[model samples]
Target: MEPSSASFIHLRIMQLVGYTQLYYCPKRQNLVRSNILVVYSIILCMVVITWLIYNLVDIEAHWRSLEINSVMETIEYINLIGSGAGYINSIVQSIIHCDKHLKHFKKTMEINKLFKQVLKVYVPWERLRKRLGTVAGGMFLTSFAATAYILMIALYMKWYYYIRYWLLYRILYNFCSLRYFESYMVVSAFKWTFDYLNKCLQELSFLGGKHMDAYEKKNRKFGLYLTEMNYQKQSHKNSVYFRFKILRNIYHLQWELSKVFNDIFGLSLLVNIASDFLSFLTLTYWMLTTMTTFSMALVDVVALFGFLICLVPHLLNLILICRICYLTTQSVMVMFFQASRTALFVHKIPHDPTNESHIMQIEEFSLQLLHQRITFSAFGFFNIDMNLLYTIIGATATYLIISIQFYLSAQRG
Candidate 1:
């Protein structure tokens, strides 16, 4: 695989985290030794927390009395704890299952070779690379902007409060937030995988429509062509069959991946999504309802920009995965529809026993597609397509309305 290809994203991430050791180190003693890095991360979290507490707790009472300042500090601490704990937890689990999971992933890739087929139709690798890079870059830039704003706040408060504590808080919070960033990489990889699959399905739709035309147009004598067309019909059938086989293999691989990462994904996403939604709603509430000084409002505005940077791209990543899956399944139906139309056209021509095999071939390809529709589901909860997108939107709207109501009631009180 090319260095920038989507298929290698997961491998690169594993290598960065040193999980690749589990794959190559055969001896049990080496395996155990290699896992020390993963284990060390969990221990480091504790050490970091201790260091943060030692510095932070020594801050003056006057700083803690500033409600807005305190609220922001509390949020930062909560973010730090949430992301750090989640990362440590996931790392521990991954380390425990390191050998088995890595082995399984490798064996799956070797045996199925579905990724190779995906690359066939998933042309223009540059587009995939650019799309992923743009989204991820936007996310990191927003995060950095937010961190920069936080630094300004720290610097501003340093004169009045403890400079050392502010610096410690800023550094620790940003470090821990890197965990959520790591989770984004995994989600982005899955999104690209499905997207590539979707593109392949679209290509298949075109091929299905042209299957007969290409076969018929092949150069052969008039009488010889008629005879050869029937035999070539089988080739079209085999081509359709092979495409479906590769698609089925992709679905299975998706399942295996989903299963392996379900807990980590489910929990990480749950926390990230929940936090993001709350941040979005709260940001809205802060903007619409609360009055503040111009400087504080500027802080809010910059923070809002940062939050959107992180929130919008990540949400779009999920939405795109859903949208592509929806489109791919619909494309399969379109393929079937076009094939059926071609079959009907084949029947319209005057009866010629010489053409019987070709006619039957078209009908069979259409029938196969009609009966075996492709559906993509994420961990079997529900299909991860436009339908999931609709559900998420509906839920978000409902919560936003409720939050607005509460905000207005508080204003009245």
Candidate 2:
């Protein structure tokens, strides 16, 4: 963007923040309420005293004086607070404000610092500029035909004209919206936490706060007591508890970061899917709007620009989609290998406490995800390739030649 455009965007972000009302301040609410409550309470106390005096002395003339005093006191307190607010506001203004020249100087300094930071992360600005120029020049060539083709496809996306695309879009939207994997992760995290909290409550209730406090004063975080009397005993050297503590902490931290990344990844997944649909809608709308002008030359330029902006992103996302699939598959395979290795190592321990049950558990966990959480698209475009490849399974080289001949014959017709 140009400098002027960048400045406008910065101004708009500030404007968005400025327009919001100050509705969420608990401190401000308490400050105002405390002042009012103290004044109101005093007035009520004074009136009660006056009523007692009037009843005892048979005098009611002081009632008006009492009313005036209450209102005046309230007003005076409000005036004081308002005056203090004005002075505080003036002080804040002086601290943040400056002459125009100084303001510009400060802005320039900030901009230079930000630019330096950005430059540290990015390639040289001149190199970036040259690369962008080459990309733009290429975009000018293929953009026109791609734009026209995409616009035609979009225009026919309605159910009446193109039921297949509409159905495909619906399926994709629904598939992404399914949160089974994410929900499983959340439930697992909370299950571990809930179990820990339950143990704390169970022990603390019977032991009482005094014992708990004494226990905590000795051992911070979680103190696993063998018994109340044994709580004071020294921790065994190189014990099971000591050895497992390090591993537990590692697993605990991994669980925390796992939940966090799961959330971020899930939300990004949903957002990216919605983005694809919205992009389709937006490009279609742009195409329709530009096509309404229908002068061939103008349409050609509009189509070219439209394709460059719209089609290029979709192409990039296709590449991204393939990489995402490949990486996700590879990571799952690695995790499987880790689990298999862990099981083998643990079971081979000398004089293993876990014998019969350990082997069963190892096998069960290794296959658990395969049975319950393994996701598969049972139906897809690859179904036709199954029969063809199976028929020529012994000679794969013949299958490609057959497919080529088949495609050529279909194309000729």
Candidate 3:
């Protein structure tokens, strides 16, 4: 089957923005792309890295020249440093792990093919296409608004300041956004697969129910002394064997897909989440300080608007990622429960050697579900879920309290 047009377009956008070095060629069954783009991406990243280093020197010099007046300034400085580090880390990781990335991408494509061709799973490409369009449009509009706001504010600044704030920062921010978009797509793929797996399990239960119902009806028709017909028993046994085997194989493939996903994107996620947390902390602190201490002047109002522009996209990205991860993990747990229930249902049936083997297969699958669980995490440091969101909120509150105390102390002094 052909790939979804929307997915193809989304990936091509990634390629245009230097997020990906190669695109898959379905006809060739391999990743193929011009080396020119690869070279260009490398050069572009190198230029950005050099520009960042130059800006760091300026930041350090500016830091020395200025007095740290408030906790807000400290938070601002930290946020800037964290953002720069995140950009550099993402770029460097992409370059260093280029081969690993390609390998994993190919593996992901193969898994997708297996689902379509061998397992006969239905992927809701239309829904996914709509989602991709909605997310891309939102990111574009948010980035555009932020860029325009920066441009308006930077008009009076020096040439370098205008270029740094308006040009370089926009580029870097878009790069980070693309990385987040990529993660969203990958996670969505996993979530959809888990959904289909659950559906398959449900159908298996229904199949068992139908078989039992047929056996009961036949016994009533043929008199209570009659056993189930030989052909009917063998046919149900065969159907059960095939269905269980397919599900088991699909679950195993899910494990492989998750591993490949982590290998390709784990470090990038870690960096992205850290950058978001720092930005969230800084923005919250700034807004709190502004609201409590400062009067509502035009200048403050404009600054607040700019802060909102920055805050919304970052917060949205964070929440969307965590929410999807949480949903995906929940789906996996649902699959586990479904598998356990199916196993129990099979156990209560009359025992034959074939039935005994099917019970063992299901029990083994249940054990694997318990032990070899799938989780979305940031380089094994923490799982990406609603819990992570809660942790961020709690940590931000604690830090804000500390900063507020210092702010109060400074005022008194």
- My TM-score estimates for the predictions, one after another, are 0.61, 0.26, 0.87
Compared with the true structure, what per-residue lDDT tens digits does model 2 show for residues 1-413? 11233334433432222211112125542111123333443454355345434432321233344353443233222322322222222222222221321233233333333324422222133443344345434534444444445556546443132223233332332222222122222233223332332332233233333443455455554455445424342232112223223223323343344333332333333343334434443344334444444576754665556445553543343233333333333444444555465554434322234435435554664575254332211022221112322332333335435645564586579
Model 1, residue 126: distance off in Å is 5.5
Supply the TM-score for candidate 1: 0.61
Give the lDDT of residue 325 in candidate 1.
57
RMSD of 3: 3.3
lDDT of 3 by residue, 302-374 (tens): 7677778778778878888899899998999999999877876666445576446777888789898998888
Clash totals for all models, in order?
0, 0, 0
Candidate 1, 30-68: lDDT as tens digits: 222355565554565467656655554654344467544
Give the poorly placed runs of model 1, Cα more than 4 Å off. 1-33, 48-81, 96-104, 111-127, 157-229, 282-289, 292-413
Model 2 off-target regions past 4 Å?
1-256, 262-272, 281-302, 314-326, 341-349, 353-413
**Scored by CA lDDT, what does every candidate get?**
0.52, 0.35, 0.74
Mark the regions of model 3 whose C-alpha exceeds 4 Å error after superposition.
32-39, 58-77, 153-163, 223-228, 348-351
